[model samples]
Target: MVRATLGESSTSASVLCRSDKINWQARNKPTIYPKNFDLTDAERIGHPKQTNNGIYFGIRMGTVYGRLADIHNATFEYLRPQGGAEEPWRIGDFRGYNQAARITPIASELSTEIQCQAEQAFACRIVHNTNNNGGINLDEILTFMRQSGMDTFSLANAYPCLMLTRKGGTTHAVRALKCWDTRDVTPLYHNGAWHERYYIGMERGTLGDAAQLLPTTNGSWPLTVSVFLAGVLAGDHFDLHNWCLTNDGNPAWVLPQAIGLYDACGKSATYTVFDDSPSGGNESIWRVYVASLTQISTGIRFVINSNRNTSSTTYQLFVDVAGCGSNSKTFTMPQYSSTNLDFTWNELRMGPPAPAAGSTYNIRMQIHSMSGTSATTLWWEGQKTITIQ
Candidate 1:
């Protein structure tokens, strides 16, 4: 039996190209040289053959000769060996040999480039923009976060990823993936290294030392002087007015006196004095004063002085306190002429209820004549501090 040389020997023959020779050999021979070839055997043996109309079976190697361009264009599917033991099977044309092996290296390179680009973008957006063009500062960013309902604690608790790069100094890059713990007190970290800082520190300094640190701009001096003088004048006037009310009488200073006395008494008292004689009318209503108090046994007292002109009439006085709760008292004054009337309201008689500590309380007073309303008028109305013991 005449046999044709295979592989490199068949390709080396100058008279005919490999494809033409293989075709001539197959047609001329009684049986193909390679054991009466079968597609199943080709697959099992890791060799595939292309035959009749571009059909392929199993893996394709250089065994079955064809046009070089046709062989290159023909699609083949087989397992390509990777670094590990298991090879991954894939399908593609000749150009895609060992495609899976190329993936990881390319991916690693791309990942590094992407990370660098991300860092550059972050620096441009945050550091460069912040330092130039009056962009946001760290304080402003913190303020915005707070306004958006994020507190320092929240920020500290957050797992924010940051790629930090310092410019203009010792250049370095830090990547903080997820590192922050803000509860009471904790240290900060940059790329696994502890960052030292303090929210509050007590450093030795004096008033003169602080004064020396003040900016020496021309406008600063006038601003400082104006603020100092305004504060001094305000303090002096406040003291003088309060002192005068505690000693003498000033109708224009009545509310200020009440507030000043109330504040001096630890905000536990409500004081008000009104002279209704100027209007010479039947009704007198005073403005409300807000006071603060603790939850304690308290009482309100009023001094009512009737003018001689107040005819035979019954006067009704009302005291209203509103705050965490509401309370009101009405006093009945029988016919009286030029007489001093005293009324007291203990906690039991008041309504709704006494307020908790630090709660604001509003006090309002009103006086009117019940009988003979036209002729009767209240000469003076005064509020004494409620006893809180």
Candidate 2:
């Protein structure tokens, strides 16, 4: 197979190409083979096949990049709803759309299901794109698949066999489908490693090796951030405002949701944190003050989910409206009682007479401190709503 890469094959630079860095006049070097292939045979009484380095059954599946994309908390979710993570899988492909989830005790210690996108990812057999862009070394991958008579790409020459064996941390082997179908995917988290029970025919295909490591391809470790969305089409528009994240449970100051999609509730999104900081240390959240040219901005309201600790906690929650009569309004969080632990809603008003719709207005929010000692926590940003017109 003939493959081409300029200067250095550090990474598939097609995604973030530098026009001037193109070594168009560079000489054709060597077709260095991939090092990650771990192919085996059906245990013939004799030796291995003489062709393609004894890779008689299958070729190494180059690389797959992924992470949990944004997850919407269904309206029915009363406890820990939104998936908690900053969305590390933001690469522009289906692999990046891989899911993630959290497993937390809701009311009892029953170990409920948080089926992270990862668990469901391998279970459902997610299909990977064969497009060689972004350094995936498609030339080599395609060559092996085609030569082995396993290449079943579509008419457009894109979607090929979604089946491949992973090598590194875990070696996952899923059965190949005669054709692709999204609706047929099922949720299977029975075990961490799910391999095909029966390989090709009624009998088994090939069993994998115990533990092997062969580093091949131009792909790097801790992969590049590739964003993805399953349903969003080839050229669909997913506005930045659609991802209204308040906090990713990081130690840094929370930035204001600029194009934040919000209502009376705090933010459209939220993540979980058990005081990622020092135990018992205090934590604070912020909403940088902002002024609108033509809109009325009211104060914010705080809503507590059912999963909050029974041992009542306090947050010195306050809001600052730049142009309002009472520029500052503080609402101390009331403790949770047996009767009030479920839906505790409190308001921090800007002493309203309503800002004129066409007039200018500015607003801000601050949580002086929220005790981070408890394992069962509440994120102020996600639970509160900002009222603005």
RMSD of each: 36.0, 22.5
Which 10-residue window of candidate 2 scores lowest in summed lDDT?
257-266
Tens-digit lDDT track of model 2 for 292-347: 11122343332322122123445443344454432222333433211111111122
Taken over the whole model, the C-alpha lDDT of each candidate is: 0.23, 0.22
Q: Which portions of model 2 miss their true places by more than 4 Å? A: 1-4, 8-299, 302-312, 325-352, 358-360, 368-388
| Candidate 1 residue lDDT tens string, 1-389 | 01133223332212222122222111011111122222232232221232321111222212112211111112322322221122221111111112112100000000100010001111000110122222112233333334544323222222211211111122111111211112112223334544221111011121223222222322221100000000010132232111011111211221110000000001111123432221454111222211122233344444443211122545565555543223333344422212333323334334334433444345555554444434244422343233233
Worst 10 residues of 1 by lDDT: 256-265
